[model samples]
Target: MRYMSHLLPLSRVARLVGQPRSTIQRMIHDGELDTFDGMVDMNELLRVFPDVRWEDDGEFRRVEEIKEKAFARRVYERALPGKEVLAERLHELGREFAAAKSLLLHYDRVHRFLDDKLDDLAERAGVDAVATLRHWLRTELEAAPDEAARAEALLAQESVMRIMSATVTVRPSGHEFFVEGNDTILEAALRAGIPLNYGCSNGNCGECRARLLSGQVSKSHPHDYVLKESEKADGVILMCSYTAVSDVVVEAGVAGAEDIPVQRVQTRVKAVERLNEHMVALRLTTPRSRRLRFLAGQHVTASIGGDAGEYHVASCPCDDRQLTLHVRRDNRPFARRVFEDLRKEDTVDIEGPGGRFVFSLESRRSPVFIAWEDGFAPIKSLIEHAMSLEISEAMHLYWIAAAVDAGGADHYRDNLCRSWADAYDNFFYTPLSADDGLATLVERVLAAHANLSRVDLYVAAPRPLLDAIREAALARGLALRGWHGEVIEPFPGAPATG
Candidate 1:
């Protein structure tokens, strides 16, 4: 009787039920229909659609049932030769599942026992038990990789070192930068302050594509951009995904004048003001001789007590030796230490004046500044710089706060910018709350700037907001080139525990 049970494809069921194939697929996907290897049992279909007459089309259902039985019989007869093989495979899978279950159960038991032990240890050590266990487990797990991977790692390291210790020199610009191990040519160049024309740095756009004049380079990563056979023959390489295996010369154009040099400066914190609950406005004064020269919208790496973090300069370059950074307090030890322990006259090391995320000095187009959270730091710098440059182009600032209270003062700088807007003919300011969701905020911003194609957009936000705005802008026909400045600082890692 079971052998006579008709099994039908989803398509066949959809055709018989007069429903869309997608509807049938959805039914199966949602567990409304039982499917085995893409075939549904006839009895199951009848249970699902009882109103349908099985014999409406001249005993078609019975004919399908007979065909299914014959197909099953044929499969059985064909499988007779490899019946032992099928049984053995099934047995192996059963044993594997059993083993996995046993292993997981054993681990659960061990974990519970460890938790008890950790509780006792935590009582003695005066630390949270789960956190203590997590630390130990992470340390042990990290160590586990070292012993198991040492031999293979040593072999791999040698091979990588041999090929990765290469330099790439760009033509015309004559800017020379050494490509770091495991870094793409563009990443290395960007890190070393060698500005290369790039958009969507992950190789979606071919803006970073360069022609190799001599030496060897290979694709170190995947890219969606296709290269023609002729272009390949001409030695064109996407620097965003390529790694040099030898000292190579490439025909890559530099973004701007290479006169700006990144420098390390030792500065003393002049003051730290609480900008909000989570943010601090840090002012640092460098020595007269060591004053940093940087373009607005650039960021700097600040190091103190062995912990370092990159922060965008919030102050304009015209402000001289003093650098202002909006430091957001988070899980990072450096940030917490800065907020709680850092004080006036505290010395810190600063690296950079890096990044090509600067305003197009020559562009007369209206400028739009979009910032979320502490992203206002870089945008603030850019606005000040633009005003100082006496650029008469209309400027707009959009402040997107996470919440009403999140900005510390209900959009602290929003009112200030609004006041500036009231005073200046070309300046405009708008404040938005994330209460409406990012999608709505993006729509509102887009609606405000209907001509996105003609404006220079300087977006300073976290990756999620940046990605959302970029996608929204692209969807609205905004040219990728219209995006000028960006300063993104990702979420900080957990604080180091003693």
Candidate 2:
């Protein structure tokens, strides 16, 4: 399940696609992307995105907010039942929903979901104000007819038209720029040397996204998307949208970058050696011969021809002068070029020491429970970092590999943990045969560590395995939120698993 990779951080990828982190994980699991090495690049992202170019279109999306002045007024007015009666109904609704998680799960009608949720709650609680709400809205909404009329007039304002513009802003590095006439924020940001977080340019991801600082705007935000009340609370806006209003200032974060730290950089193919029958070690030497500065567990990105990808630094962390990556060939993406055509003398591009997986012995909190399902690269790097930081926590790695290659798991465990002799806690890899079949393995992990109280668990694997681990951990009363993972998921895809 592992492959040689290019170094593209999960965050930037998420931003580019306008999706939460979990969605990308699911896509990778479902094998919906082109994973050259272990990373998918801009070219690949756009290729997979069927209508990426449409993001550049100037025609505004059909959202109620296109005339937001009146629309918000309408919503605000409708939401305003008599304050006393509204409060009474809201209180009753709370009690009903609190007791009826079952009923909430079954409600299916979409357009009337809000009405259903609230109405069900009112009827269950036998609240009389529920009926009053209709009469109250009928009476109140009439007062906003003039405001709606005014909004209709203002929405047709000719001074405004959503034109595409690229915007870039760099952080911690202090770089910033804006595209004057171009409406493509992704293009503008990249053109200007700004790295803002973005995944899908189609407004599906909330990453290359930013806040609309000044001008008013509108989009199909009604479709359930990433920006929640908190992120939007700070004036956050998506960079992908053709602005409902142009001439707006955007506070750029790294996902929306003028130059993704992952873009091409010249690197030399230092060497290629065998790690095992299934894995090969590929060494890359940067052309400048200077050490690439990066935090301990971050990865690097590389590409070949006009289309290269990224992967983690498989070599020791202390040495950034040259890069080492482990390539695991897959049946789908066989590595013919990298192994056969690539040469030692030629230069290649590797950008980043990417990813947020880092370790420090400076603050030892508890024993480290490290689990890697084909995620050996980052997990391996982190374990090394923990050793370097002189962390006192007892570390355990439940590393997974094919059953036969289990004996060869060495390089990572030297002077590392309770056991130097390689009797590692190895988990058998089984093909998922049916539903609830593999949940047993995850349950076993928790059962053994029942007293693993206060442990920091780091899990990296396929989406299904991760989901099983999450469910098991929660079942065993593992307080995940405090130790909650930085992973993302597309909940809509959850039901599709069956």
Candidate 3:
């Protein structure tokens, strides 16, 4: 017997099955699962994940526990949708349930009418064939279909998901993310590592405006900027002020490195964490009204107490309001200031998030990162961004630093790297000593991969080593465009070596 088809977006399907989006995509790629117009049929989802217990609350609880532990108290609270948005979402879901119930009631009435007609015909015709047909219809109607229980459970779980989050799809870029808790479209996009253009996240600037293509959204926050009447009639909305009530398609521009204008933000020092004797992690928190926007692997000029220096951001852009930079003990005035006297709550002026050494958003190839000495700063940012993006390709990291006792650039965040490797099945970490001559280190790294053509390699090192690795990698079949290198000077006055 044929059943009604319920189509779900891939993101929702992944959540329902308790799997990563990449896993679902892989299933589709391998022909293990089927999709129509990028959506999975409910029956197809049931067929592929037969063992899933949609009625079980185990998965839901597990996820909640992880979030509770992973995020700070304030952050966890912020992740929840505002009461206004939550109420609207619930109201929308109720309307859907009401409509479905009405349709079911109509179908029941039709079934009864057909049954009465069958009886009338049987009584009038007085034929054995008519009686048999009537009996068959009654049996089929009275008995439950084999998939009834599973289908009901699926619907129940989906209702909960709808109440908790909504999916959003950006046109042109085709990036998808869940609007969970109380996030506006812009907030969710940034958290998902999709760098959509925006300025003054509180809605003073009209930079985050986009045209809504489908689905419903409620204004979760008020904005001072007014939309033109024509623009409003054309379905234009400011992403920062609107919360999606259902799966939505929007026409918004995804900003590239060049597309992101330089932003000057006044930030306050949150903390100064000494990673090791040689390096300190400067944590700065931006004002609630304005956050600095920059891509992974980008460097920003930060000035504190009249001393300014350029440093690669060590934190992910997904880290809202907070920015972290790694500074080494050197003669640079800014570096010295951070080590000598920078304290909590001190004001820092940040400007010009310059440099093009950023993640290649378009590529799905496995990323191989090589960091020399203190060059791990940018590499760390890129890895975190990759994790946030949830890329399916395997990631390999190589940190070449001196031994802790040797006093060279030690792996200050070694434990953090180890935790990532332990947590993710697709992430791999390898730490090598700089003592292993640059040539030998290159050979060792190259030997790990038999084929380099399919991988995107990012290297951060002094110019000489960077050029050497690039030449060797290209000769070994690495795509020329896939090579990204950033020069790391040993000290402030050192001449850049090519």
Candidate 4:
């Protein structure tokens, strides 16, 4: 589905709402908002966030000013026939501008040189005017090489001739950006001043993944991230890693208002309670006016004493001012400080709402959440958000983790899972230990489910485990469309693989 669009980038829209650019990007990807040439429509923005005060509020006054300027520019541009027509007109105008300037400069230089020669010849030659004229013409001819060099240099300095080897048209937005012969799609979009949703600027994160609706593209770099076979068949390409070999049509989505903008907030440690020997619950409170607004399953980076690390938010979005995270004790600097030195009322820097592991609020499919150890943090948030929506579809959670201690058979927060399952008619929970082979467990669980393809599966685990389960599920005829997962960073003390 497509929505009406304006020419304002997502950043401007995010700035108006005091949110992160990623929030708006997520909305577009989730089909909540529409964009044209990387911009959102004003009417659509007002419709999406009707609560925003445009008439009386000081912030919105600035937004209105921006809107007026943008609309005026759009009106002037729309007077032209079309983008291609405008592009051709601009190319012609540019050539004319360059040619005119070059002509003036060339004439001025030649005239000065000839004028000096004529003055010199007039003074030197008394009677032979034709001879003097001949001498001057010879001098001008001799300087031709120098004139040619100057003209070449001037033309080189002008970027009026852009040889676009390929053009990328993103649809159904009707936005077009050009690609240089040697540049990747992401680089070309950025160079052409086109806004695209991306992260890391490398292929490892898969944040810039998009579908190639037509044309050819080739890999330009090696990416550590793996793409599923189904995704390949659907023409998915990592924008950061692929260069267009021909005029390509790609489909990339934009985000919406429900995605809370990410920001750096000053938070005070409200409490830190040890959940177990290896895990702790960290609660934080942000300033009243600067509270965070994030979707469930998003992450935040906590920084203190020159240390920072990303952790998933374990709390629900309903509790905006207050934050919660489940931290696993590790040798990493951030975790070490949180475990040994962190205290209540201590100030900390929290930057967040990162990651796209968010729950799709619009999806009606039954959700199956899978988590490994403390990776359950985001899953907890997702479950709470799903409950808040009062969704009618059944939701199930399968938590797999190492036993807390030797000879201990219980999983992390087993009692809570059992309580939730008992309390809610639509919710179910299963706890599994890592000792149970991942493949075996996945097979058993998937077999228990009736429609594997119709379920929305969200997983949070180490990359290897997530990959294993994904392959196993696919083998069981699970659809790849609704799969989502967060790759947990390895612990500091874990064995390093070369």
- Top of the candidates by TM-score: 3
Better of 2 and 4 by TM-score: 4
Per-model lDDT = 0.69, 0.47, 0.87, 0.68
Off by over 4 Å in 3: 57-79, 117-140, 144-146, 491-498
Candidates sorted by TM-score, best first:
3, 4, 1, 2
lDDT (tens digit, per residue) of candidate 1 on 154-264? 223322322324556688665555654456788767654455776656778788889999766767678999888998998999998887665578998766524466788
Candidate 2 residue lDDT tens string, 131-175 = 677556446534655434433322222112212222233334333
Candidate 2 weakest ten by summed lDDT: 489-498
TM-score against truth, every candidate: 0.46, 0.38, 0.91, 0.48
Question: lDDT per residue, candidate 3, 1-498, as tens digits?
Answer: 445888898888888887878788878988999999888999898889878888775436645764667767676666566787778878898898899899999999998998898889888988888789888888887888757778888988887787778999999877889998878999999998889988778879899999999999988889999999999999999999998988899999988789788989999999999987888999999998788999999999999868999999999999999999999888889999999999999999999789999999889788999998779999999999998887878899999887545656688899999999998888999998777787888899988988899999999999888988899999999998899999987533222223
Question: In candidate 1, residue 50 scores what lDDT?
Answer: 59
Poorly placed runs, candidate 4 (over 4 Å):
1-260, 406-410, 490-498
Error of 1 at 125 (Å): 99
Clashes of 4: 12
Q: lDDT for model 3, please.
A: 0.87
- Please give the distance, in angstroms, between residue 449's alpha carbon in candidate 4 and its true position after superposition: 1.2
List RMSD in Å for every model shown: 29.7, 24.1, 3.3, 22.0
Clashing pairs in 3: 80-181, 80-182, 81-181, 81-182
Candidate with maximal lDDT: 3
Give the per-residue Cα lDDT of candidate 3 at 62.
Answer: 42
How do the residues 364-388 of candidate 4 rate in per-residue lDDT, one tens digit apiece? 5789998877778899988887765
State the TM-score for model 1: 0.46
